[model samples]
Target chain A: MATEEAAGGLAFHPMDQFLVRPLFGGTEIHWYTPTNVTLWMGLTVLAIVFVLVIGSRGRAIVPSRMQSVAELTFGMVHKMLEDITGKDGLKYFPYVMTLFCFIVFANFLGLLPTAFATTSHIAVTAVLAVMVFLGVTILGFVKNGAHFLGLFWVSSAPLALRPVLAVIEIISYFVRPVSHSIRLAGNVMAGHAVIKVFAGFAALAAIAPVSILAITAMYGLEVLVALIQAYVFTILTCVYLKDALHPGH
Target chain B: MATTTQEAAGHAADAANAMLPGTDAHGSAVGMPQLVFETFPNQIFWLLVTLVVIYFVLSRIALPRIGGVLADRAGKISNDIATAEELKLKAKEAEASYLRALADAKAEAGRIIAAARAEIQADLDAATARADAEIAAKTAESEVRINEIRAGALEAVNVVARDTAAEIVAAFGARADAGAIEAAVAARVKG
Candidate 1:
């Protein structure tokens, strides 16, 4: 079966080109440039513009339908941030909310059959991670200034071993962004690859009922993974933003 | 050193062959799958732009408008309630004033009627007193004239008695007593 042939890599994989872009003369783009990311960004801009224009037009005390929806979404995100970061965590509301909306929409866009999962790629995930890392780091300095550097040291450790503990803590603190980025990319990529494998198996199977059931089950699981991955990305973002605002905990 | 370099080269070749687009030793090309990172510059640019746009909108426009609408609604409701309360108080005050005016008017009307009745009674009493005094003076004058007429009639009656006594004395062979006859006639008149 072609499915088996493709799975075994005996056949040239069409989707394999969806990786790092090969720069041609430094200016031209490569085949692996993810269109999915562009589509998601376009959709997000449209959504934001639509909400802003329509939701605030009348601004009545009794909210119109659009305004009500806008308010509800805001309240939901605000409450979620408060729950994750506690009451004083409201300062990070804008950052966390933006991250959640962007990631959730991006993940959903990636689930389409022809769409590329940009978040599944290390490059894209790394870019997002770097932004979070930079933001949190800068915020820590802005909020706490010099004291923020103390987060790298376990000051409560025994005086004799405090130096060693501080070094370890600093290394661990530096590792947070890498781990956070890799976890999202790895999970999304692994899930999509597994689903592709299962689908290939069902396509090659001679029996109809068994293969159909297997594909159905895998499809359902893929949907669940999509939702879970989005949630994981959003929750981690909240955690990181919180750390920036309150470094001690 | 030559053997070690050859071994390293061989290892590198093996790793390359395994990553090739062909079946691996396990006959599963899925094994040692090469997941790469390929993000379009345009997409990255757009995504960042979208985020910034959304953040600006949420902070500046939507939230403030929603809050303003709510505050305006609350203020309008409170003002309406306050106005209604004030109007109710004004109505109560007006009703009190109206009732007071009505009572005062009734009291004034009663006083006017009492004064009118007193004036009418005084005028009627004055007219009655004048009529009674005039009637008493006329009666006194009538009684005095009646006394004067009776005295005149008594004198005439005495003269008539003297003439009639003189005729009786000449007709009979005896003289009549005029003074005793006059005294008897006056006593009969008195009785």
Candidate 2:
């Protein structure tokens, strides 16, 4: 495979698209610097506004196509929150819904040729996951107080093994944020990278058709992955929030 | 071996530097930029902003509108169902009343027919009674006339017989009184 890659001559820089360069062609990246991430993230926000705000502006009793789409997304996320966390968990619905919409929009927008996938970066996903983690933790303490720690303790287990189980449980509990962020970022990054690799292979005349076919198939799968990842992320947030609301076994 | 490991570490550093933007060292740009520490703050800041914006838009505007439409549709459906039920009940009552009125009309028509038949029968009975009375009167008058005619025929016969008896006595040349002959004829006819 290494020889084949070398023989292919074209060094496919699949990860270069993820580079955070300044939008105006500068090299240095600062906290406030306008970069490709800023542009795509801004575009994601605009796309969300277009769908949620302008799409449902008519508020038609019988929805138009755009209105239906907006309503479908709203209802789907609403139902997910309600089902996973119950009605009590609905207080955090806006946060979870925002996460879902942003992730979904960023993912789908990334599918556009040459568009940046903001959610594909660990920085963005980590921020989202950490915020969820912090919010749920704070809410747990605020709502449940000292009893929230009972989530790590397994009273159902034997007394001798309870402490051992607690340690493992605590580790897993803390690992939630890491897994949450990486799952989304990894899935998005992998799909985009795979497509890029296939596209790079398409430059070869002998394997161009096969590479294009693979790209098309991967793109289709990536579309589903993009939506599902958003769903999985939101549901996980709901689960964490549920734990905070009722932090027992 | 130590020198070789140090050389590898220097090569790795060179590769990392080469991957960084604006570095002169050359390497394949295969590194994931997501690990780049310099861009973390920027991505996090924008993510926070975007999430906050999306949350506000959804909670304040989008969700409410969608909820309103769903609620309005549900309400409309329930109201239409209620109205349909009311109308169905009204239609049932109308049908019942219609049947009741039809029954009443039929009963009234039967009464009218019966009354008309009774009245016609009464008229027929009266006319028959009047015609019988007229026929009985005519029969009585005819009976009286028949008796009178029979009495007149009997008187004529008696007169003829008395006259014939007187003529025969005169022709025979016998000494007989007129009063006595008359008496004899009367006696014979009476007997």
Error of 1 at B135 (Å): 9.8
Q: Model 1: DockQ against the native?
A: 0.14
lDDT of 1 by residue, B1-191 (tens): 34533443454366644222223433343322233111234445655667788777766776566556666877999999999999999999999999999999999999999999999999989988988888888888888888888877777776776667667765896765777666766676568
Clashing pairs in 1: none
How much DockQ does model 2 earn? 0.34
* C-alpha lDDT score of every prediction, in listed order: 0.64, 0.83
> What is the lDDT, from 0 to 100, of the residue B56 in candidate 2?
88
Q: Each candidate's DockQ score against the native complex?
A: 0.14, 0.34
Off by more than 4 A, model 1? A1-34, A58-62, A78-97, A107-126, A149-249, B1-35, B38-46, B56-182, B189-191
Model 2 TM-score on a 0 to 1 scale: 0.82
Worst 10 residues of 1 chain A by lDDT: A21-30
Find the candidate with the highest lDDT and give its number. Answer: 2
